[model samples]
Target chain A: MSKISRRKFLAGSVAGGAAVMMTPAKKALAAGSFEGFPDGMGVLVDFTRCVGCRTCEAACNKEQNLPAPAKPFDDYSVFDEIHHGQPRRPTSKAYTVVNRYETKEEGPVFRKIQCNHCNEPACLTSCFVNAYTKTPEGAVIYNSKVCVGCRNCMIACPFHIPGYTYESVINPVIKKCIFCYDTRLKEGRPPACVESCPQQVMTFGKRAELMNIAHERMRKNPEKYVDHIYGEKEVGGTGWFYISGVPFEELGFDTHLPKEPIINNVKDFLAVVPMVLAIWPALFTGFHLLATKGKSHGHGDDHSHGEEGH
Target chain B: MKKLATYGIKPHDAEVKADGQKWSLMEKLLLGLTLDQYLDQLKRNKFNWLLALIFAIGIPVIIYRFIFGLGVVTHASYDYPWGLFLGFGLFCMVPLSASGFMLGTTVEIFGRHDFEPIERLALLNGLLGYFFAVVYLLVDLGQPWRLIYPMFVSWGPAAVLFLVGWHVATYLSVQVMEVSTAFFEWIGFPRGYEFIRKGTVGLTVSGIILSTLHQGALGALFTYAPGKVHPLWYSSSFQWIHYFTSSIPAGLCMVISVSTIVILTMKWRCDDRFINNLDRITLSLAKGAAMGLITYLFIKLLAVAHDNEWAYIATGWGAWWLFEMLAGVLLPMFLLAVGIHNKNVLLCRIGAFVTVFGILLNRLNTALITFNWQLYQEIPHMWEIVISITIFAIYVATYRFILNRLPILYQYKAQAVEEGVAVEAEQKAAVNA
Candidate 1:
């Protein structure tokens, strides 16, 4: 420990000569300049364009190879499905769901809830088993093999997207929309849900391009969409952006989500780990030595007294 | 014991039989009752039937969970990701298990050997509490079989659960080693006991280290969800301290509560030394608990003040927080003080019961009630209730089993006699062989 401190001073002078190379690239890109890889695709869901057709729901079920629902996909009555008085969002069996929210002024608004695939996704960061991965192409994929089912991701996701199929005994994985990374998005095609939407509510593009298009549509007809994009800066932005005519809060969005990803707040505590690991052993050992100094070894002869009578 | 009896030895003069012989292993194992009588006694106890009923339901529910998944047993709602299992089992159980280290420090580290008679009891309490906490965690986990994945298969060393996983694993082992010393003594493994004794300082240090990290890390786990946990319950800076400090009281009070239960229901299991020393030990333990409660109270207030949550005091949630303080913290603080000052064993016991309940309420509040503060409240499913109660019953049954068989509250006389012979042989060997 003493020698390292001494060598640090010697290394300081040597560090001056190699300063430029050692510093590495301080990439001074403009804030938000990295709008992800240029070809990285995203989905823009325009609320005004959606007609609650349920075509996309059928397509998604088939595309994901999920189990068929109890009710037929053609049945729009599936929108009224409720559990514990609240409408179902998503489940291990259903990665995406469109729920009808009736407003007094606006009549009814159908909102689709799925994994937002955040730029800095909470589920990806919170997973202790490294089960989640955010690709450069904007899809957040999960590796089920490594998943321990601690459900920290479910707890961390602000959108509450990850669903554990708790009923599956043998193979339980966190089920969520992966933006069709393996099949569709990787091929530069839209997700099956986007491609199957006959109402044309869903639009697929580059995330940055999608954001611009969402804002442009809202600007052209302010009355048709809310002023804000739902996923614009939520938890440090998401691949999916929503344009809702009704307030996002009323549409079951978590309005209280911090602008920064939840992992950012946790960094403060994580930063302290190294400091503690480096300090506690030495510090406490010193305290022990100091506290026990000059005390005749107590209890060396009294191990027998630990017994009393059964 | 058989080896010791070969040389005609007895642990204590009082343990000698009328025939001038030591009790056999069978007699000790059955507590001097014949096998038939012991079985009859077990049948006579209604609690065993109740435990059997719980195991019948719970063990299967647990198996079904592993087979079906976490969704089968729990609602598995995204809003309430953690239910009764983590809330009551992991969070509540771990703090209660803090008794082992807290007492171990009092007697071993601080050199207050007066607490020796009850030390093994405290150690057993801690060991069992932690052991069962892990059992509860296994039942709650989505993929219970891959629990080792976090440790070996995949490492998210940065995550708070990472710390919890590693520390709990390490601390559980530490506690096993700590508690096993008694088993070594009981089983007449003199060399094993000596080996463990030599490493006591190192073990205690590691215990303190692991206890500090894991207790704090459990609180830090909540830090992952800043907005999810309520403001009053959420303090980024002080939350870990709040948990760690409160665990001090929780652990101490747990030992008190367990001792109280044992004295009431299993008095025959305790030897006179334990029963006689228990009241004084309870008072001493309460003193530590009071100190912990006082520290916990101040830090809790500091968290509230740091967050400037004064306005929240008028709300319903604030009232709930106050209820937690009154029952869990302030009331116990006052009761423990009064009990210690007045030397009222009953008051100390009452204080302990309150503190234990307070700890439970605090954990439950953090994990369930105030979780998703803005979201609607979640009433656990009826199935969830049955499962939680059943697992708790299993915990109680296992605790009773160990208390009945192991030299937890009582010493094993046979081991001591064997140890006496071993010491004599070792001395003779040093002189001759």
Candidate 2:
């Protein structure tokens, strides 16, 4: 019992490290507003250029080595599929899907459903095992080896990007788009989805350059594109943003999302945590002193007598 | 067990027998009954049949979940990632189990010894509730084997779940220690019992810290999904407080509910000390619960007001929320108030039961029902429901098994019996003189 086991020693060090890293005050003070890495890459998507060709989805499936879809990617009938009163979303089997939303002005707007790879990702922040990481190249990648399968990342993702392979009994894990980090982004090449677009709907470049390009395009044709660029300032900005000709809300975007990071919403509670941890013991121990002062010390004495207490 | 009482037999509640013989571990586990007698009693209890029925249907499905995967047994929807397994099991079970720290604070820290009769029961309730919550988690976790990843393999200290995992694990240990006094007494481990008693204050205080953090942390987990949870059910700043405060009433009421069931079904097992004090302790517990309810209610409304979500009150979800508040919170609060004022135990019991239901409703509403309100509603698959019921039944059985043997509902009479023998020996010596 006196021996400190290896696991315990490692646990203590990890806990110590976590405590140092997780101090909410330190974080709040250290980081004011982190938009994105200066040189990090991103994609600019123009909804006007997208023709709902579904080529990007096919490219993604092939690149990620995902299982064959129930319907072939070329089938336009897949656009009509809806589940739970919503349009088709990316699933474990498919990392990216194109959902078609009909607009009053524009007959149909194809929205690519994939990981936004936020500058500050909610999934990355919400993960307890540090399973998700935001690489310098602006890819939100997941390490499945350490994933406990709590699925908190799924709950935290505002974009609803990650999917769980629930069918796998032995090694179910989160299956989501990694922005082709391993094969493309690491090599400084555009992702398959972006490169495979025949209409060149997506322009891959540095995040700053893309933001400027999106604004320039919006400025060049103010009448054609919506004034707002989706994901530019939404949920702390994202690696992939859209300049939709139609309103983002009409195109199935949650426009009402807070501009600040999702973790900001949690900071208030986290700030209180250390306070509770620091103050509760002394306050409660003082309470014990104030409560039991000059009274029966051990509970065993008065308990048998059935004394009334408040 | 009640049938056994009719035969002039008593369940084990002492270390030594009336004939001065010590009980074997197996005899102690069987409540001092012969194997045949224990088997007969078990066969006679109708509740065992129901438990058998649940285990029959649910255990196989649980094994099937392990073999085939969670996709087969659950909705397995990515949008509704946590269904009944966590919604009912982890979120709901944790708050109700707050009784351990609540009662520990009351009897140990606050010097309220009068509540001691029910303290062990609350501790046991807390321990088993958490134990089974973990069981549910293990079943729900994608890789239950790697649960320790957060502790040793990797760390996301800033995440709300990290705090939850740490605090729950630490507090579970604290509760096991708190509840172990009864076990040590039952098992005749005086040193262990004494050791635990000496550290009661430290254990109780640590329990408060862990309970306060993790209980709040559970709510904070939802704050990570600010857009997903319905605004009526979600308050960023007040979310943790709502969870932590509501847990007090939930915990108190759960203890009250469990004790009520114990008093009704296992009256013979309860010693005179427990039986006599049960009503007063129940009322006392109800008073705490009522106070907790009012605080919880006030904070819940305050959160809505703070968030300026009055317009949501007119919607259907709002109506459902109103129903939850009125039926679960306000009604139970009113009942407990009336019951406490008039010293009505039955009404208090009813209020406690309703409060437990209310906690369940609120957690399920937050974690499953109203969550992803912008998305389609998710109804848990049939097998998921069965698994939840089966796990709860196992919890009940474990609770009963402990209460039947571990001197939780009843005091250990061994010490008094030894004193009785001492007096008898003194009388014999006096006569001889």
Candidate 3:
């Protein structure tokens, strides 16, 4: 039964090897420092500008057609709800959430959490079914149909985004902010959350232009901001850049994330794969011939050879 | 079986009975015993009752998980996507099953026939461990039906899991072929056994290839979560190597542990050849385990030094890491060394058990316990724990079932293999007369 399968595998491996050899290592290395696709749109979130009102969250739920909130969006008590010591995070039902982080002097700083939509997304690279896609329009979207629900993306996501719909028995898939990819971002419109914000806390524009605007704001009134864009160079730069009044670490961001993309960390091991596939068969076969040179072969012969030598 | 042996009734180990009558398939399946006697022995065995109790609770919970979904049974949310199912099952079981290739290399590749008596056992261990690991993976996967997506429907060849998926699928087939030789012998299928024998070298070589890549690929999967896995356990440069190297001893020690259990619990099934040569083979396997452990220790230290993580040693996690190394690695290595020096089989067995536990600890530490160190830890749900125990019980029971009937611990004699030819010759002479 397996003889045919392995025969197929042997052919498959050769083709796979050729494919690996054909793909230039330079392209892989280029991805190491890849910031984002040129002309991709991005959101610049200014943490200094927002009131604690969750209009964005309410708009996101309606735009995504998600389930109604347990408490109405106006209920601020949800901010105090902590599960597993973590403040409110995005779930399948709620695509975005606003968390209240208390600062030393500035009272409660309201931080809206959702998918950062990274340029070189860990989720995209970690997926074994090619379920995730980093669109040219700067959105990281996922296909539910092909999703095997391995959850490697959840583990790989540096920002702790992308919740699973574990309640669904038959068709559970990853649920995360897609930057309103199908509905708004594709047509060059701002997401519902961005447009719904009464405080104009977020600016939707070209990623390069947003970077310039962010730096200008920090340069002009340096004391008003923390002088750092949290997503600018984190995990190879997320499309959702953030300029905060407080330090990023204070806002519960993983500040120590590597500047290089997460896939770069895995590249070393990936490089070894082809080498082993190519080398091990001959190497061990050579050992077989050498070890059993004058002795009885492993097959069809036993005790007579057993006591003679190791 | 022990009670049956007292009556001088031998179990099935040949194709034909002593009277040259062909043994029926039913007789072979029942280990040459009547159904009543077979059922009686099973009743007398205390272990079967425990297995029965586990399966009673576990099977329903497993079915319930499918109906209610993974969330009801497991604490697998966004933070901890893999709980005990993968933490203990996939990570721990794969390494412990490494014996297939380890012994395959020793006897088949290197022609160290001295280890031949235990080679089939090692191969079977590999086959079952991997088969059950996939079982655990099936339970853990949210959409287990789409498991073939990585192979047939979709392609994400760049992902570490993609490599893992392909290698495991391929390696499992290879192990099935390797272990089928024993099955063929038990059922009196010479053509199939001979066909498998011709490809033994090819299969063993492929086994080594698949084993190396997949074992390393499992570690490589963690590289995708560099920030999640604790610094003590994470090494981008050496993580795969660490997993591969450590699996060497893990596999070797597992064989030792399994053999020890076999001797203690079901010595009636083991043939004279296996019963006598087991001590020497255990010592030989222990040497290999020792070599692997020392190499693993060196590389583990090198990984920490390579990453320049010595400073983390002073912290709480660092202390815990040190404790793992001392208790699991250093202590076990010392015990094995002392056992070998004294030629003490019992000490070696104790050391092998400790080594097995150490590998379990290492895999669990890498995949679960220390994973998401920065986040709050989540214990597996009650039903999840029950299901995990139940699946393991099934593995143990299946393992015993195969060992009890198959020619794994003992050789099926040659007379049965040549019985057909001998009968044909006699029948021709009688016709002429």
Candidate 4:
């Protein structure tokens, strides 16, 4: 064959291979349009009703069998403490913590931050080792066995909930609230924090139903609460929804977050992966042949002759 | 070297030894110095002692990290997810190691045979840098043994990490293949070297493909955190491009830096061809890096423009961004231009070093310093610093070892090369005719 024909043939084959590799991903994307599991469970937090009593904190601690906090949950002094100039969210030590936002207009609106258990959770999607799993019941749980601790999920998280036990010498798992999935939520029971709330601030139900209930409460009490449900459309809709009299941003929510899932940001790159894999062998092989066509195969052979010695 | 008196230490010198006696492996390994002289040279370099000190202190800490877990070594804050290991090792080191593919393309594939003298050094530098980056990653991982879990255990096909994991693994192999030819030359294995050479086009093409994907994949890893990585530093659509493009200069500048350092420190080990061509190669490499930096600068702005991030430029992060641009991108670019214009290799050398520092600062900023701009800044633990420096010391040591022995700095003339050339022609003829 002429050099041109060979080059054309290789390039054509590579293009064909790339097309083959990309077809499935494109098909999957066209078919999968983020229709979340319809019956997924969710939590609705009425921030207006929360008094920062720390009842939910104590309940989460008790249910998870976590180490006791330095101060008692009843000691209200913990609420005033701030680290890194921001209110506390979930940590390895604290699975769920309700931070009190002292708003000028709304008095005190307590916003609870934990794993939003996003419908399309970044944590679940970013884990390379399958460390995290988002169950149908709407809890994102993690396994420590395969956790490499690269912490890309920590970077990916919009709410910044997953905490690593850097203090542990061995088996430092990512610690976060599993929404009581293992012990309670899976059995159709409310999470420990929700069940333990004194003011009934948390309402647990099917995620789709809870969203409707959140909208209903907002409509019924338009004068009493903010119109927004914090997690309803944030990061592709989290299972946890928050309603407060104060604006969501004031309560330390990442209001700038896009409505699409974090994984959606990576789709453009992932779409190219298989294409490169299938096309590169032929593409570069063709380049090699074309570049070296008229030149002596002497240098090329000399090159590999050198490689084998290693 | 005593064996290379007139040849100098550059790669361009085609001078045959006056007596036509090839230096044996042992003499080359000893830099043509006898055993005692080699030992005396080792004792003379105080930097070796410093490296010893760092490993003495840091190696134990690494062991401690493995035994006790990452928590003992790093602050392990929930907010600051990745600390020194990832911030410096994986993120920074990978880009610097882009030298392999960059040089490989220049010397081998594109027929820029002028770069052949310094090509092996660049390839060795890349291979060692990447190998050690993985070393640091192993220390930082919670389950270091299960590092291959992404490949075999359970795959998260859709994850950005899936891309990073697969690409890094594959790219590491491609680099190994690219570097192996030098090893084969050193070891006198003609067949192995010839086999790999036959696959050169395939390997080089694979190198480009792998380098492009993983370099971009590293940036794509950040896309998973749109809200966390500052808007000025992060562009969802353009982050991959910024990283991939900057890496071109970053990798090229790294070759210039490594070559410069090798010439200055290990001149004795380098053959005449490498030593004589060092200055010209440095200037040429700097020119390439300058173009890369200019492209990088334009793309960074384009990324900002694409995102309409004009508002971020006025903030403190913007100032930080400008500083990165001024020092990292623009200053080296100007210096490189001047260096290339005046044919001043020293200025090009300086430009290369500056560009290297700039790449380091950029990676550190993206991975550690400016990550979670809204969150508090984290100072890496003392142990973390110790381990990071120690690993870097090991990288330098390995690089030196390879440069000393491999045909990277000095080509080997062996019996097989003549026969191998004939064999290769036959193979090509068989394939074509």
Q: Model 3, stretches more than 4 Å misplaced?
A: A1-33, A303-310, B415-433
* Winning candidate number (lDDT): 2
The TM-score, computed over Cα atoms with residue i paired to residue i, of candidate 4 is 0.89
The C-alpha stretches of model 2 lying farther than 4 A from their native spots are A1-32, A298-310, B415-433
Q: Give the candidate number with the greatest DockQ.
A: 3
Candidate 3: Cα lDDT at B355: 94
Scanning candidate 1 chain B in windows of ten residues, the lowest lDDT window is: B5-14
Off by over 4 Å in 1: A1-40, A218-225, A298-301, A305-310, B1-27, B43-46, B56-72, B411-433
DockQ of 2: 0.43
lDDT of each: 0.75, 0.86, 0.85, 0.76
- Provide the lowest-lDDT 10-residue window in model 4 chain A: A301-310
How would the docking of model 2 be graded?
acceptable
Chain B alone, model 1: TM-score? 0.89
How far residue A243's Cα lies from its native spot in candidate 1, in Å, is: 2.9
Superior candidate under TM-score, 1 versus 2 = 2
**Can you give the DockQ of every candidate in the order shown?**
0.27, 0.43, 0.46, 0.42
How well does each candidate superpose onto the true structure, as a TM-score?
A: 0.86, 0.93, 0.93, 0.89
Tens-digit lDDT track of model 4 for B25-132: 676566444565456546667888988888899889878877777777788777887888888998999899898889887755565667777777777777787888
- lDDT per residue for candidate 2 within A60-116, as digits (tens), equals 999999988899988999999988988988889899988899999889888888999
Error of 1 at A189 (Å): 1.7
* Candidate 2 TM-score for chain A: 0.88
